[model samples]
Target chain A: MISRHGTPEHLPVRPFVALVALAVSVATFLWAGTAFAQASAAWPRVSPITIVINQSPWFGGFSKVVEAYEKETGNKVTLDVNPFAGSGEKQRNSVRSKEGQFDILVMNSAWLAEFYHGGFLTPLNTIDPAFKLDPQVMSYDDTGYWDAARKSNNAKTGVVYGVPINGNIQVLYYRADLYEKAGLKVPQTWEELAANAKALNSPPNVYGMVQRGARSASDISYDWMPYLHSHNGAIFKDEKAGDFTVTINSPEARQALDVYVNLAKTVGPPNPGSYGQAQVIQALLTGKAAHATPVIAAWPQLDDATKSAVVGKVNVAVLPHGPGGRTTPTLGHFIGGIPNNIPKDRQVAALAFLRWFQSYDAQVKYAQTGQPPIRSDVYAAAFMKTPEYRWSPAVLASLPNAKMMYTVPEGPQIASVLELRLNQAVLGEKTTADALNTAAAEIHDLMQKAGYKTARLPPLK
Target chain B: MRGTADRASAKAADRWRFYTLAPALAVYLLLALLPIVNLATMSVHDIHWQQGAARWTLVGMKHYAELPRDVLVRAGLANTALFALIAVTAEMLIGFALALFVSRIAVGRVLYRTIFLLPILLPGIVIGAIWKLMYNPDFGVINQLLHLLGLPGFDWLGSGSLAFLSVIIVDVWHWTPFVFLLLLAGLETLPQDIHEAAMLDGASAWQELRDVTIPMMVPILVMTLAFRLIVSFKVFDEVYLLTGGGPGTATEVLSFTIYRRFFTEDRMGYGSAISVIALFLLTLVIVLFMGMARRRMHAH
Candidate 1:
């Protein structure tokens, strides 16, 4: 309604233009604020990632983490859970055949070398994916990590492939009431363990010990590791030697096998040679067994009144000492990694998920949910205050001495080779020494054929 | 010219039929034969994903040569033979009796047949799980029943040869129905004249069973026994679920052995070699049995 030169009905064109500019300025400011808020809430929605996991507590715990990450980052996580039997092999077969279904894969630490060398795993360091671990959501405390755990995933070239998630260590689970009634001490040596077991055992009612003696790559091998390690036997003499020669044939190994075979014959479950951890666990839970060497991670289930019959009646102690004068349990851990086939963005997203998952809060929740913790700090004074986590002290005690299984490119194959022979010894089909020697020879042949630097070391002096 | 036209039209019709069937035939070849050819090829090559991307190298018959010396393979073969012998024998005898008994019944024959068929209709996994529960040494109903009878309980799946026998029991329970159904069909198809003549001759039930039923059911019996052997040799799911070829490989069979080699050990080439060998063994058994069956038919 304005005319130029101050006419009566004219308004100033500059004022109209200024009014329009003012409205535009206010609207722009409001839009900018909303956009900033939205950006912070969800920066980039990642393409969906597929994951494979066994039905371990870690898998269950990670499902919760997946839900949390989805809300936080606007990314969808697809979980493919495998059953307890042969899940490891299925994952490997599918991924190696380029099924293109998975973005992330989780496997045992024993399998790290096999997967890494096979190019199925991406080196986490190249992407430094752990950097995506949010400090607020995840514990960044260096002290929280166990010895070498933080850096254990690093390859020889200093590339990191796997991120440690959950770990396992073995402890002696004993019937405390039975021990008290029998007037026995917690056995410290293998000789004492056998004697105590034999003393407490009565046929057809109660047995001295229950153990997994089934001839499987995972089942009985894990049960045997503690004895093997406690006897100072190892699968390899010097991994650094490059030839990676196995040392399971030493006298120490034979001694361990002898103890195992004797236990099955004298005080173990009636058919211990045919059963695995499930049977052993069943025996212990039902009060049929007075002693067992169950993984500490699984002990919480034994303490829960809802799941176990021997709640509060069972107690944990260090594993009985072998000839080496100390107790040792075989080391096992489930580790997570981005598959090498994943594009960089998906790998980064997987890293983000892991970083948060391995955070302190998540590990605490993991422990709360009956999984053994991978962190050192979880057992520190403040965390173990909860009464439900009855085996934390024993787990902490066992962690320092846990010996990881042979981790090599040929690890899975080596395990099968060793398990078959070990079981043969258990069944009295072969003498302990004979089984060890045969197994060692076969493994040596396998390594030599695989073209590793081939040198068989003499017995450790 | 008219005859040539007619021939041309008939040829066109035949070609059309083949074209219509081509897609299905192609799919069948792809699904069945390709993997077999690939497995044979792989058996001769050292192909494993142990180093990640399956490293393929031609290794000849190394895996086959290793089979005899391989302890697991030998154990698997022994166990499979024992399983086939025990399980097939039990099922055949029991199934034959049940068929004869049911056929003699004048009432509720359909109901009895359905009840007998129930176990086979259930999935193998379900049967395995149910039996595993029943075999549990501690609280399983089987042990409880033993206790009620004031007899000592046995560790059904936990000890020595018991594990093998336990798996056989499961196989029997699941597959006896199949034998019964087949033999019952054979029994029904038999001419009533033969049985009538036996009855008219004042033959007792035992005599009739021995002379008439036994001789008449020979073809079906042979087929059933031979088929059961092949299925029993390939016993995997039941054993895998129940005992996992355990109690120190007491129940290990050829299929389970192949699975262990192929998957657990990551030795695809070795496993393929074992499979090829098993294929040949099974083929030989089938061919020999078929030839024997033909001979027996001719004799009849």
Candidate 2:
């Protein structure tokens, strides 16, 4: 009977042990928490940010800026610079898939609208109001960004989703020596340009002109947009409208396509339909093509010791006007945006790095390395006045007049259809009207398949 | 005495079973079966890189339905099949000819075998890059040679048809040695008495090869062909490093298409759908080949 009574005492003893264990655990956890808080407070907040950039000279320059930023801000940044070959669509899909691999991305203006609308990117508006109000830290000036870049930043969700990293506009490059030899002045109109191209072409050796004809997003659209805009054929009904209607079959657009086909067939290289950006640049640099419409970013390659043959002789100018009496070069600027996957500390660090990288001083530093800066003041700086960039001021001046390419949710698919038609047209497999109609049909089908409503454009007056 | 013998027989059987089956079964489960099972599971799930989670909801037949509409996918599948058929056939014929030629050689047989096997020792990517440079339109050795010969230089990779043929040529150059090595081993191991008897019976060299030698070598030939078929169907590195499925989807294979959909398009579910389809096709081919091989072995 006494042993049974002692069991109750043992039970109380076990409860006491349990309580003691719990108290120790709580004390240890609190101590560790305080220690961690102190350690973290002492350490400079290091955020791991990943920046995805399209391959170009500008990206090369940006890498140096990133290095400087990491050194100054105590942030860890992983720079992923993918080459231009398949990167446009790859980046788009990655963002759409919500691959949090990127904290910041340098994307072309054409992708801005799609990425913004798809909720792939975070709005700057959602950022801390304090960060938005800091004039020195964050300034959203319409003039600071080029006109086309500003328009592209107008997200369908009515929030700014991108900031222009650098200017990437198309400009006409011609061999001054060849133009002089042919007694041709710089062409002011598409007709004059075609005539000059014909006059300068020497078959099987020297091509008159070249542009990207490869079947990818950038390759097809970069070469085609200037023609479309010059003919006054808009991709959508209006910039503000969210409708996806394509006016590719408009008379002006067909005429533009016809002109393009004629140029590629008669004056362009024999295999213009298969040429890519590299080939097109090579043709101009190797003196095989008298003229080409290349992204201004490629202009620096003309002076590369290992690649260029016509270093001093090549000149850059705005693309020739078409029937509309205006030449709207397509904007291919890379925009910087923050990824939302990262923690708050990392986001702040990344934003700091971005702010420092886009500063006036950093922009000038980039200009010295052959990348044209996004800021207008950077162009007027002394560094850009050097002999290496004697033509940069004029190139910079052309950005405001530039127009953004068509931005659609299914931009790549639409680009692919157009690429196929352009190839067929260049190969003389189909007439301009036939190719445009087919392309329009394919684009319509693709949009519908992607769950976008079929858009009907208002008839042209 | 009967009990003792029964115990001894059981021990021997256990030892034999352990020695023969354990290592192979372990390897199959670890290296092959596990991955195959994992891939099969991944095929049904949508995966992407987002916030923190990488995979999304189950998208069963969505990707399969989209396959027919994808022009690149169709082209890639067709190209892969064509490449497999052409490369396998060419490699077998060329490899067999070299094996027969080397087997007859009285001098430098070892040297010839060593040299013939050199390309197989080289890495696929290295071979691909070397061939890419050679096929370059401007300043490439091929065009330079053609220019010297007073022939117009052709765009090897620029043209779709030519690019497909160019990749096959490179593959043949690299893998014909693999076939040759297998065939040589079979030829060298053959009983000398049969050839001697055929020759004594007044059988011509052609007749001996076609009747005695080829009939004996059928097992090895079938084995090599099956192995090469599977390898050629999964041709990814060479084509990827060389053309990157370009000059506009001209040389894209099914594997490359799947990779693009998975990594480039970020349509992991769609990519897995293609992978499942590829897996099924490959398994069917393997089973059919194995069945044929079993029949051939039984006949022998």
Candidate 3:
């Protein structure tokens, strides 16, 4: 039907349809332009990168640092926090999945070998040739490198695979008030520490000492590593030298075991074999024990008035030395790395985050958040001089002398054996010599089966 | 002609029955048999992840051969067997007694049933955590009670000798209610005419229970025992949260070992091999129990 003002009504409708088409074309052009602009602006990444980390004392601080990173870079990051054991499983699953789940893997020192040996990680140097690990951060006994040709972890020649995130190391936690009352100077050797334990010896009311002798996958063995390493004993003859000899049953190790067992049996809690990290910390905070060697990360609870009965009474010191040996704390640092399975863009984004994380400012923020800073400069920060940060000095002093348990991928599997046997020894189920010998034998069989040239020490006669 | 038509109708009914079952059977096969087949395939191969892809290296019978020598596997087998035997027996006996006591009650029966079933209502993980705190030597209620009595406190789950027993106690406490509920249902469904007949014959209550009621309840008892035994064999949460196969593998069970191998050790091939064996053993148990049940029912 024709309209009165126009030649035809459909002629007026033609312009309306044209207007609609023109608007849609303009909208499509604008949308495409904005998307292209975003693609250009969001260089290297548009999707969020995920970091898999275990829940630990430093997790809060680490999460804060991650938030700082996100704010600074405008890059999205998903912090996939899991329980300690669950994190490892998550990392393994992520790396093994068809498309990896995590961009960054926060690996425990114990499991670093598995990641490194399995080629599951992307070497940082390969990502950026000029990206050098900050020298101020603790090297964790050169755990960041893997000598692919030598099949060993060595900082001097191996490729850089990870950066230290949490500077975790064992430190001697002691009741300073008890020491003052007993008129005892700080112990310089394991022997002296033991003597002091004997002096402060009391049961039920207060144990002379409490040790983490529980047999989780690696708890007891981890607690005993300080003793073992300080005693000039090693799980291998020389892991750095590519020597795969099973030396856990060496005479030095036997003596170390003897000391560990004696302290656990005589001075520790009644159920020391069941005392994991939590139990040890509880014993210290409640003033039920006078001494312990928990990770420095646990130092925050010592002075927390809300949790501690003996606040301001505890002090930190380097783990005592063995005869003819220097103080050696066990390195329990958590290192962060990119898995090889992720997309190149994600890998780049992860590397960028790590690079920013290692900056001096980030380290300072990390320290401010009550996390153990990995950098030496952060350890010497003004805030560390306060009474609350009293443990920082000892942690700094101990980290340089810290040693990783093993540099082999078999570290965890082998640690399982030691954890069980050492726990048995602590519980008086096996003699120290018998336990060490059995551990060495089992480790030898394991390494050999894994196609390593390994041999155990002769049985302790 | 009429007989032939009836025969043809029966054959058509059989065809209809087959058609009715086909879809369900296909779905069951797809869900169940595929995983079993995949597990079998994995057991014969050494699997390694390379750039997020599983690289399968054929190593036929290697993992299976290593199973016998694996100390953890052996310990797991022994502990699992021991745990099933003791825990199941305790649950069955205690459950039977509770069922008998509740069935005879004329008042507050529903309340007693609810109270008895409370343990099973709690999640296994929650139960494990609660029991762990209760067993703690320092501040736990068990030791605190002992201390109040001026007696020495004992480390219940810490000692190698006591850890396994402590776990068993937790299992028995948690699952007894399950058995009780089942047995009570069985008791409720038992015909009352037999009990009345026995009473009219001047048989005592105990005699009626032993000779008339128990004999009638044997099939149900056997079925309940088998179910409890199967569940007990799969115990992991209690062991995981409480002892974690600690105090020198005292409480290590098959499921925990498989968990360690798969998750902790990342030995998928070996873990699958262990799983295959466990599945086979469990299936055998199920088959044997069903056979026994059928035979007992036939005898009755």
Candidate 4:
């Protein structure tokens, strides 16, 4: 067997067997070593979690943060992205299923009340007694807390159910270059804003302003909230104070309507009633709109060079106030909560992810993705000093004065009625007074039917 | 003895038939009848979601009582009726014309048929999104063409006056091919000698169409129109994607109302009530059309 090479063709049988055993032993040793390292280095007790989220302006940043979390924790995370309009149904179906399809549920503020009152979420404190939300995290009116007895979202008397993930609020976006060129001061009041809009308006080129007046998926009603609140008007007598008197047709509301409708008709793009969140943002990105008060989440897309034509040319400011009122931007935050229907293990894992999500370190990572982090301290992080995050200060300042559009479970239904009426007024289908009056009457009826002590309050003097 | 035996055998045959149909009938009852029954039950109650389960309170037809006063219901019913009327009429006329034109052509008929059928082949959602982009005021192809022609560009889906008509146009574009295909099949099956006799008798094309083609095609025409009308009543996607039943309540229809109440507003009992009413109306329309068709068949 060894004739060609002048060596033993094969080792002696015992030596050959020993050598084979040695090779196999080394192989097993290395394999066991790697496996032990993997088992030790991986998460102590990892459970794969799926999050149901809607496609939004902040989705890319959210996805990036999730990827970072997966890398750091060695846990599998799946993001189930759905259309913004369809996300509520997706979340509802998931929660209602026998075994929940999602571990994490991302809810918009408009629908948060329903979920909160429905008791779909397991309170965070119940999952882990030691886990507490970071003090610096913005509460967006303490929506994270739910008072089961009061059926209300309250910081003082409620338990922690969800954590704020997105600090979205409407802020004034304007073309800085145009403002500098025109020598116009930044508007601080509704009247001042109207004047500024009039000064810059030029049709088919650059409009003074654009408003989201479309009746699509809560767009028009949400866009009108700042106007209503800043004008000292309210949907109810006071939603948080247990007063459900319908006051949407108050004189202050009429004044707000006048301001809103006048601006849209006189200075906004043609057929402003058709403009939605997408259209308003598109108008700003294309430089066709000089100003708008879109949600702050859209700030990232405004400076994105690929999608925006007005990169670095736009600036953010606190939304202007109305006469006799203070700045009150509408809160539009997204919250993450664990659905009660999921397995306990999955809930614990989801809670772990949410706990880490609010940590100072994770907040910084999120801010680096050019999206607003829910934690207030992250606004002062080093990465936020970059030009890409120029809008952070304005958002931080605007958040303290932000108000929930409504705090009751009937908020969405009420907003639907207002959406139609407000859109009708914007399109001149009805007079502002008539529209508000009709909406007020309908809301009163709805509140009455919902077993509330509601009154159709007389219009204010 | 033979009669009695025949009667006994018939009873056995009837029992066999019932046994044979039992599975399919059960499936149909479970899938279709049960849901409608549940919907009817839900309509008479108040449903609230607590956690993952439903809590239903007996409301004693209160939701149905409120329907007559519901603003959206009134608006939806009016808009749905108008939409069905205008859209179905336009579709029938255009579909009839196209079918007649394609039937007369001696060559390239397949190409013509294929070209016309492309719109109906597309999914409704795709049709809705495409039409929405096309109707965009600033950069849409329709407005761009208007601008290029030195004509004023109007917001098609944005204007309160034009929004409903704009949706109707999209529906006509998407479904005219359906009517055309049905009518073409009917025309092909039509006896050719009658048309020849009419032509030989010095009847003009209009005369032939009116007296021979139309009268003879009544059954197919009724069937197509009824189908289109029923479908048009359920129009939701175009209204949703284009204008969202806006600039105001300009395009809100029955199905949109049901969706708003069911999905958006989360008023399940109220939504079920509206759905039951819609189903009843559709059922009535079906009955009326079936009766009309039977009468036409009997007359022929």
- DockQ of every candidate structure: 0.48, 0.09, 0.43, 0.73
Clashing pairs in 2: A98-B49, A98-B50, A99-B49, A103-A339
Clashing pairs in 1: A2-A11, A3-A10, A118-B51, A118-B52, A139-A360, A243-A453, A274-B247, A331-A403
Interface RMSD of candidate number 1: 2.8
> Which digits, one per residue and each the tens of the lDDT, describe model 3 over residues B131-205?
999999889999999999999988999988899999999999999999999999999999999899999999998
Residue A424 Cα positional deviation in candidate 4, in Å, after optimal superposition:
1.6
Using lDDT as the yardstick, the better of models 1 and 4 is: 4
- CAPRI-style class, candidate 4: medium
lDDT of 2 by residue, B141-226 (tens): 99999999999888887676687888899999999999999999999999999999999999999999998999899989999999
Per-model TM-score on C-alpha atoms: 0.86, 0.81, 0.91, 0.92
Q: Of 1 and 2, which scores higher on DockQ?
A: 1
Report the CAPRI category for model 1.
acceptable
Question: How would you encode candidate 1's per-residue C-alpha lDDT over B31-125 as one tens digit per residue?
Answer: 99988898999899987553347769999988888889887799898888888889999999999889988888989999999999999999987
Ranking by TM-score: 4, 3, 1, 2
Q: Candidate 2 chain B: worst 10 consecutive residues by lDDT?
A: B46-55
Model 4 score (lDDT): 0.89
Per lDDT, the best of the predicted structures is: 4
Flag the better candidate by TM-score, 3 or 4.
4
Of the two candidates 1 and 3, the one with more favorable lDDT, higher being better, is 3
Q: Could you give candidate 1's per-residue lDDT for residues A3-62 as a string of tens digits? A: 455554654567788999999999999997776567445445556777777786346556
Q: How does the DockQ of candidate 3 come out?
A: 0.43
| Between candidates 3 and 4, the lDDT winner | 4
